[model samples]
Target: MTKRVVHYINQFYAGIGGEEKADTKPFKEDGPKGPGLGLNGPLEDAEIVGTVVCGDSYFNENIDTALPEVLEMIKSYEPDLVIAGPAFNAGRYGMAAGAVASEVITELGIPAVTGMYEENPGKEMYSKTAYIVPTGNSAASMRKAIPAISGLVNKILAGEDVTPDKDGYFPRHRQNYQAEERGSLRAVNMLIKKLNGEEFTTEYPMPEFDNVDPAPALKDLKNATIALVTSGGVVPEGNPDHIESSSASKFGAYNIEGVKNFKDGYESAHGGYDTTYADEDADRVLPLDILREKEEAGEIGKVYNTFFTTVGNGTAVASARQYGEEIANQLKEDGVDAVILTST
Candidate 1:
């Protein structure tokens, strides 16, 4: 028996405009469109009967309304399965795809699948809600994404076990099957393998997180090169970089070569916390005032010429990680040996 499927894609994938047209609302059409066309041919056990198109911005910004409308459209198709975009690294698109897939699976009790980069905010938001196949950072991986998605769909309809590792998909962070051995036995086996320097996979894998080992302490604070990095969204007056108050897509490096404190004109771009206090005294967030005091007292080395800043309010983990890496690289190049990182 063939499984009926519904395909979802953002504006760009449907021959619609990009950011400018992102306000387009939910719409539907018969048969597959865009990436779905490629996916349709490869799916052996499923047939895409309808395509639901929604703009990325519209879906995300108006999710309260747009999601229901989109879900209604998908429900009209009465699909046995739903396949959303291989949204790649486009944050908004990835989020929309994940949202659609999640709704279909949880709300409608239908199998839903999508593809996106591992770092996609969608994967972070909806990995447990949907079966997501991994893809490259951009649509350049369309060829690869389509096939991977198709494979998952085929296996899903055939009632095959779609493991994340053996098959190529993000872990759903769910385990519903029984294990052959008890938890303690598996743990002991894993420990033994670790002791012998052998490879052993954990029965229950934990979520991914940065396990940064502490760096050796700076032996000489008086001679150390200290730098300030913040996700507190503090910025110079006027926010020249136009860094967002939330979900900041970029970071700014301001020249503080002569700046001793933030007294004259600095403010917080962060939206997660009260901006009044931060705007009134940006040093409260970045703590440059204290650092300056320590420098003047010769308790610590000079503050680096530049300070890194970004708004962490609602920022995706992937974006934050990227910003941190970039900032670290620049500081390393400048021979900055120590950093004081602040966050809201």
Candidate 2:
């Protein structure tokens, strides 16, 4: 029997518009649209019964409302399987796709799949929660991504066993069945292979480093309201917030208004690097003293008084991204035009 599938995509793919149309609300079209059209050939017996197009910004900003509304639309089609984007490296689009895939799998209790690059933030946050096929970094990979995604969807809907290595998807790290050998035995066998210079595949693989594209350079540095931020874990003298030296749970905002030197009472809370030098002078890490000089010298405009700091060591990329986002939002609202970020 042919399976009915619902395709989810962002406004840009729907040919509605690009970032300018990213605020478009959730809407449905009768059949395949944009990339959904690419799926028809490879999907074989499965048909895209309806296409759900939502704006990247709107869905993320209003997820609570958007998710249910999107799920409702997909439900209208009564699809046996659901597919979201091969979102590439787009941060917001990847997030929306991952989210839709998550709900389709968890809430709808159906086979759902999305594709994205390994480094996409959405992969880090949702890959374990959903079935995510790894794709190239851009839509240029669309042709290749479609078949892989569809094939897996078909296999899942047909109740076929799929492995991460055999199929090109990220590992979900779920142990749904029992292993013949205990974990200790497997570890010992793998260790012996390692010692004997033999091949071994680890059950769990470490995640790749996150891909963070830096913001565009400031066109008007002399007029920009610059802010200071650090992952060096620099904080007040007494370590008031007690941000962990490693795997910091939270970041802190401190007032540096008109303060020239960190030596006044600042120190490094970072545990990754040697603290001796940073202890004597936090400026060694944050360099706010030099920034103040730049401000006074009129080389740049005003310095944003509120400086943000966090410890990067052993902190998950998800946590770091959350901190960066929260800090960025406040900085944008406060009219801070630019930021000088330092890391150790």
Taken over the whole model, the C-alpha lDDT of each candidate is 0.87, 0.86
lDDT of 2 by residue, 1-344 (tens): 89899999999999999767877999999889999898877886788999999998688668889999999999999999899987887767888888899898899898789998876777877888788998887899998899889899888878789888888788877768889999999999999999999999988776566577988888888888999999998899988987766545589999987688897699888866898889898899998888888888988988898899988864545568889999999999999988889997
How high is the lDDT of residue 88 in model 2?
82
Candidate 1 stretches greater than 4 Å from native: 1-4, 15-31, 45-50, 53-62, 90-92, 158-167, 173-201, 206-225, 236-248, 256-281, 293-302, 311-321, 335-337
- The ten-residue window of minimal lDDT in model 1 covers 241-250
Give TM per candidate. 0.75, 0.65
Question: Residue 179's C-alpha lDDT in candidate 2?
Answer: 92
lDDT (tens digit, per residue) of candidate 1 on 1-344 = 88899999999989988766877899999999988889999988678999999987677668889999999999999999999998887677878889899999989999999998887878888998899999987789888888788988898899988798888788787667788998899889899999999998776666777789999988999988899999999899999987766556789999998788886789987766878988888888888899989999999888898999998765667788899999999999999999999997
RMSD in Å for all candidates: 4.1, 12.0
lDDT of 1 at 255: 93
Residue 208 Cα positional deviation in candidate 2, in Å, after optimal superposition:
4.7
TM-score of 2: 0.65
